[model samples]
Each structure stands twice: as structure tokens, then as C-alpha cells.
Target: MGGEKMLRIVMFPWLAFGHLIPYLHLSNKLAEKGHKITLLLPNKARLQLEPLNFHPSLITFHSITVPPLETLTLPPGTETTADISLNQHGELSISMDRTRPEVESILSTQKPDLVFYDMAHWIPDIASKLGIKSVSYNSVCAISMSHVRPSVLPKAAATSQVALSSSSYVGSVPQWSRNDHNSSVYFGDEITLLERSIISLSSADAIAIRTCREIEGVYCDRVAATFNKPVLVTSHALPDLELQLSPLETRWADWLARFGPRSVIFCCLGSQHVLDAAQLQELALGLEMTGLPFLMAVKPPVGYASLKELLPEGYNDRVSGRGVVHGGWVQQQQILAHPSLGCFVTHCGSSSMWEGLVSETQLVLLPQLPDQTLNAKLMADELKVGVKVERQQNGWVSKQGLCEAINRVMDEDSDISHVVRKNHAKYTSMLISPDFITGYIDNFIKDLQALIS
Candidate 1:
């Protein structure tokens, strides 16, 4: 470490909370190591990170205005993808692409040593022109990245139809070709983000992922080989602060306290995906059939004013004492940490996967998107810490399938449940070990310093 200079790093994450939060966490970690960081985010998106406390001396927040919604044909004040419907994500990506000038302006003024950019393909080129090194930071896990490498993806056929639902999209999840090669074929809006991710990875000096080798060691090795770049794992990024429960959280805590230890299921799909009326009804019926106490956080589909409107008739009264359906955001981390919370019926996003793993909550994966499906496969097939709900050939999860998955995970005597619990315990201990995070971060910083030097 002799004669090494402290670096100035610029962090530019994608316009999504999932991506932004991790970047901010990484920024905080870097700041703790005495490096200066300037985080560039859209004006509104910056507000979401304001609540988090960071080392003020080393970390600075720079807000860049997103392109006008009118030009993008998006809703007013739509700065982040969460502000818009899933169908409008491509337009949001287009808007994000237009911020290159703002990013370049900041780079010109700040003159940072290195820039870490998310899946924005243009940033790497800009960094190159400015003679600053750039790294691609993928918020998704290594397994998803490895499976989606250009060589591994399937070629789209001319006759390929637009998928009816996100779940039906063939290339969204990893599929094997006839030649025994892992491949996926993306169509429509998925192509835009996928292309950007590929380009960003291809253009970067190196790549960083928010994962640890303990969980996805093979995938990490494969990703480094496929991308032909130094891939650094930032370890599993956990919440920087302990969750402070809100009034609603207090109420839910009171309700959960009545349940036996590890008896309740916490069902929440991550922010973006909204279930259609049919899927909602089926899920409701499935949870009702379990008769186990559950707290479900939902965002009703378009045209539904509230959860009551979207849920099935008499559903509330049928499960009144045992179930609570709270609309809008809930304190997911706090709930997961609760002792009564036995299982998490999750969308299998990286954040949710880490949270569930750390909380030692059994995972019942109902993956709605491709990346999530890969995460589900990792948990269910590779890690043996979760079970994927059975989906029909058309990728539909029926009420029976949902019920079976929940029952299987909750059943203490079942082999799957026992294994899941054991694996969860093993992983939780490893992740929370004192040296686990510190050692990875130290090695990561040393590697970066070596590269730049």
C-alpha cells in the first residue's frame, strides 16, 4: 500500500431503485476506504438516497435532470423506471441514453480517475475519450450475467411472437440449445436493456458484481472468462442501516407476534412487476388455501383502485384473522427479520434473494422475469435453499402450484424443507461472518488500485 494515491471515483447507476441502491452502498463502502466518490443520478432518483447517511467528506451526490417526459412519451415527472409502468421501460431507457451530455459535463469538471457505470453503453466510450478508466458494475448476479453473454444467447427467429406475459418470454430465463450450450433469446423491450448490458460489459475496462463467490463461484468464474475482463465481487451487499419499523410495521409486528415461531409467510413481489387480475386471484386463493398467517404487500394492476378491488370476492372475510393484504410498500427487511416469518414468496430479484438468505427465511420463488427465473434456478437447483413453484408449459403458475410450493417449504418434516433450512442456516452464517465482507472489500479495493496503478 506504500505510495498509493487515494482515487476519485464517479458512480453512475441505471435509473432504477434496485440499481441505484447498490451503487450507493458501494459508494459508501469506497468512501469508508478513504476514496472520494461522486454519485450521478437523476434529480428525483437522488431523493430516494437522501435518507441514507454516508461519509459526507468523501461522497458527493450529483443530480442530473432526466430528459423531458413529453419527448419520451412518458408520464410527467417520470425520472425512474418505477415511476412508469413496465411496458414503458424501453422509453425510460431511451431517456437514460440522452443523459450522456450531462454525464460528460460532470466528468469534464470532476476529472475523476475512474468511473463506474451501470448498463448505459455510452458511458464507457465517454470515459475512454476523456482518458479516464471505466468499470461496468452489474447489479444483477453473475449467474444471470453469465447466462446472457452474447455467445451464450440464442438467435431470435423471424416468426418469434411477442411473449403474452413476461413469464412466457423464452430468453428471459436460461435455456439450453440443441448443441448443449446455455442460451436465451430476448424479444421486444427486453432486447434494449439486454443490448445495453452487453455493450457496457464489452466496453468496460473491468466488471464488478454485487455477489459473492460462495453462492455463485462457478458462475463468477464463467462470467470472467466469457467477458474476458477482471470480474470483482463486492461481496453480498446488505442494508447499511438496521430497519426502523414504521407504524404500519408495528401493527404488522403485533399481528405476527400471535403466530407460532416460523409460521407466517411474507409475500411481496419486488416493486416493478404487477400481476394481472387472473394471476392475482389465483395467488389470493392459493394463499387462502394455505391457512397460514401471511402478510402480502401488493400493487394492484391498472384499473384496480385498491387491493380490495383486485382481490377475489369474500377473500378478505375468509382470511381476515390470518392474512393481511397491505397495498403499496412495506418494510421488507424488517418483516423478513421477524421470528414469525417462516417463508418468503419472492420474485427472486438479487436484493430479495440476499435479504431472504440473510434472514434465513425459506424461499418460495415465483419468478416473473428472466433474470429472476435464473435467480430462482440458482436458489432451487444449485443452492438448494429454495423451491420454484411449478409452472405450466406456458409458464403459468396455477393456484395449486402456488399452494404446493408454500406447503413444501413450510413442511418441517419434508426433505426439501429440511434441506432448505439447513442451507439457509449455512449461508446465513457465512454471509454474516465478521471477516466475510471485510476480506472481500479489502481484496476488491486492492485489485482496483493495482489495475489503475
Candidate 2:
């Protein structure tokens, strides 16, 4: 290892914004450490990195134009194998067929010192054949990784249930009675995810977790042992942007300004989760019932045409100028940080949770699918900064229940709000700062340079 030595690195991410964004952060961090990076992704994913356009000094984006796979019809806006289940192993075969050539070509020409890839992609072997070290980056929490192993599936199902007492208790995983479905289907998918994960883990030089050991230490230990590698756990590293709102966004801000500090509620279900017609109407009705000044970002999937028709009569007209229902991408971090935003009704994605916590928003978790349930459990149960919306209507979480939860959180007289505010302040202090994350990247590069030396 020597001063000012630069390492050439390449990152290949599956075509999903969640995966692409975190890897971009990692690329930026590495670039800051004097590493040259080549990021390979689809052109559509390029738009997500546009916000970071000013950071051309550190990272380079190289678009890999591959024909879309003919097999496995993907839902609109849904990308990656995690979105659906593979009835057979043939799914991975088709994926590798489409991606391997492009991956190999890049490695052949670039001859990077190291390669980093998403867990789903099977290009670790290609990196090995090229005599290059590589690492695996998982977008989800360690708890999800704990469940990825087949042997641990049964244990996880039982432990996850027993780990939490209720939403009232701290450091406990919340019970999702709805998880009956995830548990039933998990028996098979567990084997599939584990088999693939084992292959990817064995092939990689090391693995990185987008989490801290302080928050998920036990699960991190399980992952490190399962993968048989040095597992490096780092907190989420987001770029410090000088955020400015557009004129339209500024109007939204002005409306928010009307609400006193910690008075307004913000609700958003991340980009991927869409509401059906029935669900959309139910949500609009529920929000109106709460009688709260709320900001909601709604991006229903294309097929859900009935959403507009289903809205309760005059619901939008009644709330006119008081709320904003954005149908497209919104600057989530900026909204979360706004002082008027007192409470958050969220779908409980890890990134969303981190942003809420970082911005000190009182969290009201509504986990939709995938790792979100686990994240909700951690926030409501472990961290105590948030509470889960109580289940009703055969555990479907009806609109009525949604309204009740929002009412409770927005209640100025309740002790829950006071407790939540204090907890958010505590959570922010306990979590590592952005500067600490940058320092971790510096240390990682120093160690990698030592390996080279």
C-alpha cells in the first residue's frame, strides 16, 4: 500500500433504483478515496444518478445496452429476480445468459483490481476467472440475510415472532400476522435464495452490509459465518446535497409552513408499491377522516386505472390547496427534513426509515412487502421511535384502521406524540453520522491497499 495509489473498480447492479442508488453512494465514496470506478447499468437507471451529475469528478457511468430477456415477463417498473419467484432454476440461467457477456467484456477491457456486484447477479465467477477480487452488496437488512439461509428459515420464523413482544416494546421484531403468507411461500424460496446466495458468497472475496453492527449485530454474525468472509457493516452513506425546491415544490413548502412545528403528517409509499383502485379510495377516505393537514405522494401502477374513479366524492376538492398528491418522484429526503413534518406514515423501506430517522420525523410504519416488515419491526419494536398501524379486517389493514392510527399519531393531547418525538431525537443521536460513514470508506480503502501491497 502506498500513498496516492489508485485502484480500478467496476460495479454491476441489477436494474432497480434501490440497488443502483446505494452502489452509486459506494462508488462516490470509493472515488473520494482515489479509486477509479466504472459503473455498468441500464440507460433507464441513468436518470436516478442525474441528481448526482455534479459529482463527475469521482465516478463514471458506463451504460451496458443488452437486449431485454425474452423469458420471465416483468411487471412494469418491477426489475430484478426478487420481485418474483422462480419455479425452477431456469430463471437464473436466462439472466446469466443475458448479462455474462457484457460483464466479461467490461472486465476484459477494464482489468479492474476489484469488482462489486449485487447478490442476485452470478458474475462472481467471471471476476474470479479474470483473477480479480470482488465483493457482494446487499440492499436489505441483516435480518433479511438471516432468513436467506434455509436452515435458518424455521428458526427465523420462530425467532422473529418471539423476538418482539408488541409495538409497545423496544428491540423486538413486530409480529405480522399477515406474514403467514411469507412464511408459507418462504419454505421453498428460502432454499432457492440460499443456494444462490451461497454460490455468490463463496465466490466473492468479501461482503459488505448496508447496515451497522450496533443495530443488527446478531444477524451480522450469522451472515458473516454463513458466507465465510469478513463482513463489513457500514451505515447508509448518502451524499450531502445542497437541496433546493422548485417553484412548484416551494408552494408545497408554503402550505407546509401553515402548520405549526411538528403538526403536519407526511405519507409516502416508496416508488415500487402501488395501490389498487379499492385501496386508493380506501386510503383517500381514511386520510380525510383524520382531519389532518397531510402531504401524500401517490404513484399508483399503470394498470390501476380505477384509482381516480374510486376516490371518494369531493375528497380532493375538500382538501384542495391543503395537501399535495404528487403522482411522480418527489425529493423524499428534503420533505422528511422539513420542520413542519411532525409525523411520517411510511411503507417502512430501510432507506425511508433511515431518512425519517435522520430527519427526526416521528415514524408511523406501514410495511407493505419484502424486507419492509422487518424494518418496521426494528423501528416500532426495537427502536421505539415509531409505531405500526394496527391490523384489522382479517389482517388486511383496512382504511378505517389506517385512519385511526393516523388520528392517534396526530393527536396533540396523547403521550404517544411526546414519546415518539423524544425517541426520534434519541435515534438520530445513536445512529452514526454521515462523516463517520465517509471515514469507514477511507479505512476500507486503506485495508484494500494493504492487501495490494
Q: For each candidate, how many residue pairs have backbone atoms clashing (under 3 Å)?
A: 1, 2
What lDDT tens digits, residue by residue, belong to model 1 across residues 118-152? 76766877787787888889888888888656543
Best by lDDT: 1
Model 2 collision count: 2
lDDT by residue for model 2 (1-453), tens = 346589888888655567787888777777766678888876666755755643576578887664444555544433343343333223433443466677789898888888877544356667767778777777677777765542433433322211111111112122331222432322112223334444455556777777776678888899878756777765766655443222337866777888888777788988656666667666666676677778877775445543445566787798875655556677777777778887788998777877777776677888877578888888777767777888765546777888777766667578876677677787677664666677667767765565445
Error of 1 at 223 (Å): 1.4
Quote each prediction's TM-score: 0.89, 0.82
lDDT of 2 at 430: 62
What is the C-alpha RMSD, rounded to one decimal, of candidate 2?
7.5
Which 10-residue window in model 2 sums to the lowest lDDT? 161-170
Error of 2 at 306 (Å): 7.6
| RMSD list, candidates in order | 6.1, 7.5
